[model samples]
Target chain A: MSNVIEVKNLTKSYKEIKALNDLSFEVTEGEILGLLGPNGSGKSTTINCILSLLKYDEGSITVFGKDMKPDSYDIKAKLGVVFQDVAVFDELTVYENIDYFCGLYIKDKATRKKYVEEAIDLVSLSEFKKFYPKKLSGGLLRRLNIACGIAHKPKLIFLDEPTVAVDPQSRNSILEGIMKLRDMGATIVYTTHYMEEVEMICDRVIIIDKGHVLASGTTDELKRLAKIDEKIIVEANSFDSKYIEEIKSFKAVHSADYKERVLTVSYKEGADNLVKIIEYLKKNHIKYSRVYSERPTLNDVFLELTGKELRD
Target chain B: MFVHNFKYSLKALFRNKTLIFWTLMFPIILGTFFKMAFSNVTSSEAFKAINFAVVEDDNFKNDEVFVTVIKELSDEDGDNRIFDTTYVENEDEAKELLVDGKIDGYLVMPDKKDDTPGVTFINNGINQTIIKNVVEEIALNEKIGNEIGETIVKDEMAKGNFNIDIDGIYEKVMEKMSDETNLLDKSANKLDYSMIEFYTLIAMTCIYGGMLSIASINNSLANISQKGKRVSVAPTRKLVTVLSSLLASYVIQLVGLALLFVYTIFALNIDYGDNIAKVILLGAVGSLAGLAMGLFVGTVFKAGENAKTGILIAITMFFCNFAGMFGITMKYITDTKMPWLTKINPVGLITDGLYALYYYNTTDRFSADIINLIILTLVLTAVSFFSIRRRRYDSI
Candidate 1:
């Protein structure tokens, strides 16, 4: 696939703190590239640098094969950005707001009307078209914000934590709308703190921390990097620490812990690992209600690569 | 792109109740207050014939010139009249009227050889002054014309032409007494000092254009507002957006100014000038200058939104106060003591332009003030644009 955005050696500093340090990444066309990072990890700064909204100390950013600059309207015309904040006019109705923003990119009246209506439908804000932003609920307001950004139907879009503080339903609808946008042949660069959102909607993910990208790959590929072959959970009426210790001695077991009425065993790598754990439990007569086995999720990969350190 | 930006900007600003209130409705409300407060003042200051009582005594009957002068001065006809004269039966009645404040003053005819007929007043004031001046001028005319008539009569008698009708001669003298000069020249001067208050109010209203320009700048620059970020990232050039938004501001301000002008000129009954077009032109330029000043403030300062708005209002009102919104003489003091401030101050410039239109006979001063305001507008607009040109925020 062709690359829509490329960044090389991006560095940004603010007074005494470094925001982005030699960060590099590329977003290929026709895919949702999730930029996953904890708070204050240069995700917003990176997106701002790529959008030419901020000047970096050292960087080269190109969008659609052109060096991105503040005056790069040609490149910006095909780009849409939905900031993390709910940026919209409170005085304008939903339709008027969408029309005003859509008019920014599409000048033709008829085409703009069609696109505005389509966007209103895409976000499912048809009923609230005539309502002012202040009168709408939080979820409806968020949908209106999205409609404003994507109404022009730009080829590349940047959604900076679009689902932050949103309810589950709205977040799901937003994710579905974003997927629909991608299916319509647009490249999306999504940023969020939610790891599941990245795993659910992102075709590829970049895990970053401390102004550095620790790893980047598809969800399954990134999970493999965690090196956790299986996670086995056993629900039991009673669990003994001796049993946990015994499970920990197994050659395939990486770690074992028992909490409440359940016991969990993480295996490093082994085929039939679940079977071995089940046979051992049956032989020890460790009564269990349910047992399940699963592979490591994308969050496990994130925690493994970025380290489970608290960031401010 | 410009049209789209301008249209949306107009819509947004119109919907902004705060802007609408301050720009359009507040000025009208203040004007109503000014009208109510100044109406009585104008009425009290209007020129009306003074009232006086004359003592009808033997000395007064002998003084034919005084009698005729009073007759002509207090005639029933509105024209060529200065006093509403009443002849009293005695000095007690005249004094009673004077003390009772029914008449402004009383006139007494000369009774003794050393006595001269003169005016008396209850107190020294504008009405008393008017009555005193008119009575004094009549006394002087009688004295001068009496001497001239005596000389003419003696010369005619010496030439043995004594059948010249001396009474007719005296009447002619009275007729030609004050014909060479008029007491009050009301032909050329049209300035009513009370109207300066309204002009200053209009001047203050014009400066309210700052609100619109500040809104424009705030809505177009990324660091100023969230809407600014969207505007910055739009496909349209930033310059186009800024200028179009400014044009929208100018239109809205001009409309507000026009409303103020119409209200003050017609509804409030204040005379701005006879040249309506020129007055409107000066006001338009003043609004532009005011808008530019606000844009300059918005672009040059990175203050918060409310802070910037407060600064704009405070600064404009400061200049307006100096331009005499509070007192008419303040403008004169500022003009004389700190003439450069008057030249540089936008509100002062607009107030002076309107003042010149009202008081000055020629358009020279008005044109100069207009030019200065236009230059100020251009300079401020240039500085504002220079400050905002391709500006990229370190963070937003």
Candidate 2:
């Protein structure tokens, strides 16, 4: 696949603080490129700089094989952006808001109408098409905001935390809609702090922190960067600290902690780690209500790379 | 793109209830209150017949021209019944009537050959001034008539014609003089001082249009609103968006002005003079100045929408107060004391323009006001354009 967007040595500053520093990445054609970072980690800033919405101190950005500038209308025409904040007119209804934003790029009335309807359907806002923005709920308003941004069906779309405060159902619906967009053969740059969202939808992931790209790969590949290969949790009525020390003594055990009657153990690398822990629990006569083991998530990898939680 | 932006802009502004109230309904409500407050004032301030008495002595009776003039003026059936006169037999009787406050003053006929007619009043006021001015005018006209009659008589005698009808010539001269004075009085009566309140009301309405433009323009600035960021990211030119938004605002402003004119004219019985077209023209241009000012405030201020709105209100009210929206005396004081302020104030220019159209015979002052308003509009528009033409910002 060819690159739809290219960034090299992107640097931005706000007075004394650097918002982006020597950041470089490429968005391949027809794929979902997740920009994952914690709060204040320059995710939105990077997207803005790529879209030419912000002036960078030093770097070059290209969208669709052309240098991006504020007046790059041809590139801008094929780009759609859903900002973090809902940006729809309070005076307009859901349908009208979508139509208005779409009208900016699509001049044909018939085409705009069709596209606006399709957007409403994609966001599942067909029942509330006539409702004004103020009358919609938070999730519905977020859906409307998304519809307004992508109504024109651009070749490249930028979605910045579209489900920040949304409920699970709405978040699932939004994620599904984004996947459909990606399936429609359009390139998408999705930015979020939620690692699950990036893991579920993004074909490729770029983890950034402190204005620098920490790691970039598929979710499984990035997960390998974690120091531990597996994590185990056991809920028990009573757990002894001595057993946690014994679990720590295991050759594959990286770390073990017991807090609030829950024992969590990290394994460096091993197969049947859960079976081994279960056997040890049975032999020790420790009555555990639950025991489970899971592979390292992107958060673990981010924690390993940044020395802090991804949510931090 | 322009049409699309303009269409949605109109819808957005029209649906904004706060903007509708401030720009359209607020002005109408204020204008109604003004009409209610000034209704009695206008009626009370209208010209009324002066009450006075004349001491009917031999000289008063013998002065046929003066007696005829006074009788014609005091005639209730005449069109120019300027005086409600009661003749007294002697000076003492006239003095009693004046002291009784039944008459504004009493006119005494020339007591001696070298004496002239004089008016006496207990207190000096508008009525007293009117009586004094009328008496003095009659005296001046009589003197001029006498001179003219004498000149004609002398010229006729010089030409060796002794059959000169002096009485006929004097009567004709007096008749002509009275006719001209009556015409001047009629023209002077057309000056409606209370109309200043209405003129200022119109000016206030025009300036209030700035509120609409401020609200509209604020929606198009990326730093000020979320919608602005969406618009800025679009492929369309910023100038088209800004201009289309302003055009929508301008149209709404004109609609508000039209409603005001209609309500004031038909409902409040306010007369904006015969030049209704010029009044509408001045109102339109003044609204343009208002829109330009709003654009300037929206683009130049880094404050939020509410803060910018408050600033615009302060500006509009300042200009309105200086132009005498609150009271006409302020307008008079400002015009005389700070003529330069009036020249620079857009509201003052609009008010003065309407004043000129209502009161003046020529359009010189009105034309000057319109030109000044246009210049102000252009300057504000240029500055606002410069302020908003930037495609990118340091921060948003």
Candidate 3:
């Protein structure tokens, strides 16, 4: 498969902070690559380096086999950028905004008109075409940002946290849009802090932290790499930390956490772990309100790989 | 791509309210100010204010002629206005008053030297040339009128045509000549009044153009503020962007100048002059100078709206002040010898061009005005070129 983007030994720094350290990545045509990282984990830095928006100390970045610069019109002509901040001309209405963005790419008025309408339809913004960006809700504005970015139907796209601060409904629609773009054969590199989004749509995921790639694979594959198998949580009025540790002595229980008058027991590759936890709770005479048992998820994988402590 | 960029500039020009106001309305307001201040100069009143002050000296042979001429020149009902008059003590006092804003000009006469009498006039005025004309005409009238009055008195004494009362005959002839003097001043001043206005209008136009240039370039540079971010991703080079943007603003400025001309010439019937072409040329040159100045400011510093607009106003005001916008700024200006700075100054050049075209004939100096415009345009272009080149959009 032909790779749509290629970055080799991409290293970038700002003063003393190393934003990207010898990063290497590629996205094949028609594939969706999710770049998952916590906040300030060099995700944006990587994307910016790839886009040539920021100069890098040491690296080579190519899109469609050509170098990029401010005057790289040939490559930039096919480029589409949708900043997370929702950038659109305030003076222009929704339709004009899309038309103007599209106009930048496609000058033919009729062709631009068709593409703008298609973009509006793609974002489900037909009803709000006449409204200004300020008049639209956050969801509609986000959609408008998407429409403006993708109206020219670029072959390669970098959707940087497109669903940040969006409502659940808008999130679903954005996810659906990503899927539709992927099906339409655009190679997309999506970065987001939301691991659930990575699992939902990404064909492949690379998780990075502190300017270094930690783990990269499919969701299930990543889950397998993490040692913890299943996590069990029990909300109780009061639980002794020592009793939770005693539950950890169970052969299947890999680890246990007790805090805020509740107990969470993580088991290693086991099915009857929740039942065992409940019995242990009852025998201990701990009054529990509710219980949940779930297999290892991408979020669990994320925390396990990047430590459970809060990052600055 | 260039065409779209041009269209984008047009869209920006039309839609951006602040840009529109600065480019179009600002100049109109400025022009209205010029029109109000210069309204008197353009009307019939320009003739009446063309006065000369005569200082009475001790060694004068014709003291009676000086006082009688003054009295005759003054219209009885109309403040005895004869191109307006002022009587002062001596040359120093007359000129001091003229300089001190008490009179337009003062005429000095040396004691009658057999055939070589000297008259010196100091001008404190709007129409110095007109004041000079009044002084010269009065001097000529008194010299020849006195000669003829004395001749007629002697003829009446020798011919015995009447009772030979020499003083009475002199008075009658003087009265007759005084009536003629009044007629001559009235006709001459009325006929030549527009010349003064023509020069004033040219100066005012230059002021307007200079000020508007600053505003136009400022607004043009400001137009690029938002697009500064887009430059990184845009297809066109920064050179193209700046050039195209400046060119677009140049067009808007031309429109502003046209509006001024229309308001003055067509709407208000203020005759700009016979040389309409020169006026147009001056407007174009002045606008270019303003545009270049704006570019200089834009490229000099990373400016916001207030500072950007401020620099524009300041530069235009600076240049316009030198352009003699009100005839007051350059009143005491004694640098007429080196007309290069005044002539090479874009405002000065345009004002000079307009003045020549309106009042005088199309001389070589008018053509040299083109050279002045060329130099100014080149200077501004170099400044703008360097500015745009040095203007880095790194991480902006």
Candidate 4:
């Protein structure tokens, strides 16, 4: 698929702080590209610059083969953005809010009504269509905010932490709905701090930190970038520390430890690494209750790429 | 898109309880307080006939013309009657009645040749002072007429004209003086000065339109509100959103002004002005100016929302008070001491425009005020528009 959005050498600064530095990326069509980062990792700033809602110091952004600008209505008409903060008129009802926002791009009343109804159903807000924003719960308000942003059926959609502060139920529903949107042939750029969300739906993920792209690829591809290939855990009683030291001497074994009747080992790269560990436990006469092996996850890759520092 | 934006803005603003309260209900309530406070003031109601005590001494009984004039003034059946007078037997009796507050003051007959029928009063309050001035004016005119009649009669005698009617000449002179003065026991409409308060109240109501302008600014700028950011990112142009919201606010403010005008005239029975069309036109223009002033303040001050609101209110009250909303002579003071202020201040121009329309016979002054008010409205609107039009924030 051809790239729908091409951002090259995007740089933005606020006073003395650099928000985005020499950031370059492209989003392919018909794919969910997750822009994953911790809080204050320039995810929102990058999305804003891409949407032309903000000005960048040195960069060029192209959407649908055209340069994006403040007056780029043609490009903006086919774009939808759901900001991190819920943004809907408090005075308007759910249906009216959706309809009013949808009317901005789709002027035809008949078409707008059809689209508004579809959007309401998409977000499952039919029961609360007549409710004001203040009357709705946090989850419902977030849903309503999403409905307002996507009611116009824009081809390119940018969702900035749409599921923040939402309950698990609403988060699942929102994730499912986003997948459905991508299935309907809309290119989406979803930004979030949660690693599970990126692994769940994103076809390709970009892990960013400090205004720089640390790693970008499929979830499995990102996981492959980790130093450890797999983690092996054995719940054994009285496991010998001598065996732990022996396991650490193996070429494939990155590290091994025995604590609290559990023997755990990390491997660098070995398809039979788990089998070898289990054989060793049996040979050493270690009584094991449960034995399990797990593959490296996106969280490990994220932590390895971006240090574990507290960000506000 | 503009129409759509305008429609939603109207729906949203109309439902705002705070906006409605400040724009409509607050003015009506304040107007009620004004009516209750000024209910008994003399200028608030029609002028009533003054009560007087005339001493009936020997000098008073000898003056037939004075007695006829007093009788005519004391008669209740004639429109020429103004004084409710009672005849007392002596100066002590008149003085006793004046001290007892039974009458405004007592009229003493001229005891000396050049006294000119002098009068005295117990207190110089509005009612007592008005009665004293009226009695003294009548007595002085009668004296002058008598002196003129005597002079003319002496000239006639010197020419050997003995057929001249002395009483007729004196009566003719007095009648001419009464006709010219137009204050001789004649019931005429008094100019109500209390209307100035009501005009200032209206000026205040228009200035309260700052609330709408504040709303407009909050709605248009992205830094202040989330709705602003949402609209700014939409496919529609930013200017369209600003203009549409402003138009909606202008329409609501104009309606608010009309309701206040009608309420003051019909419900409160306040005399606004004779020309209804001119008043409405001036009110519309004044409301526009007020709206512009609010917009300018809201745009110029990038402070917090509450701080901006307080600033708008403080500025508006400052202008209204200077225009004499609290004191009637404040406008006069501003006009005299700071004459240039009345010409430039929007509230000053609004109240002065209404004042001119109320009192001045020619539309020249009223037209000038309206023109100045329109120019002020345009200038404020332009300044605020240009100041806020292409504002691209460094950060939102």
User: Candidate 4 on B1-396: residue-level lDDT in tens?
Assistant: 999989988877787778888887888888888887777775556656677888888888887667877777677886666678889998889888888888887777776745766565766544553454355555555666666677888888999999998677767776666653434433424345566778878887787887887787687677667777677778898888888988888888888888888888889998865677898888888888878888888787778657877887888788888887787657656765697888888888888888766654346667988999889888988998887765455677
lDDT of each: 0.82, 0.85, 0.67, 0.81
Candidate 1 ranges with C-alpha deviation above 4 Å? A227-295, A307-309, B40-192
The full ranking of all candidates by lDDT, starting with the best, is 2, 1, 4, 3
Q: Model 3 — TM-score against the truth? A: 0.69
Q: What lDDT tens digits, residue by residue, belong to model 2 across residues B45-148?
A: 76667788999989889876678778877777776677899999998999898888999999888867346787888875546755664676566556666666
Residue pairs clashing, model 3? B74-B80, B75-B80, B75-B81, B213-B290
Clashing pairs in 2: none
Ranking by DockQ: 2, 1, 4, 3
Query: What does the lDDT read for residue B159 in candidate 4?
Result: 94
Q: What fraction of the true Cα-Cα contacts (under 8 Å, chains A to B) does candidate 3 also have?
A: 0.20
Question: Residue-wise lDDT of candidate 3 within A3-120, one digit each (tens)?
Answer: 7788888877777888788888777888889998888888877776666656788878888887766457788777676666676666578998787667767878888889899989
**What does the lDDT come to for candidate 4?**
0.81
Q: Between prediction 1 and prediction 2, which has the larger lDDT?
A: 2
Worst 10 residues of 3 chain B by lDDT: B214-223
DockQ (Cα-based) per candidate? 0.45, 0.56, 0.17, 0.37
lDDT, model 1, position B250:
89
Per DockQ, the best of the predicted structures is: 2
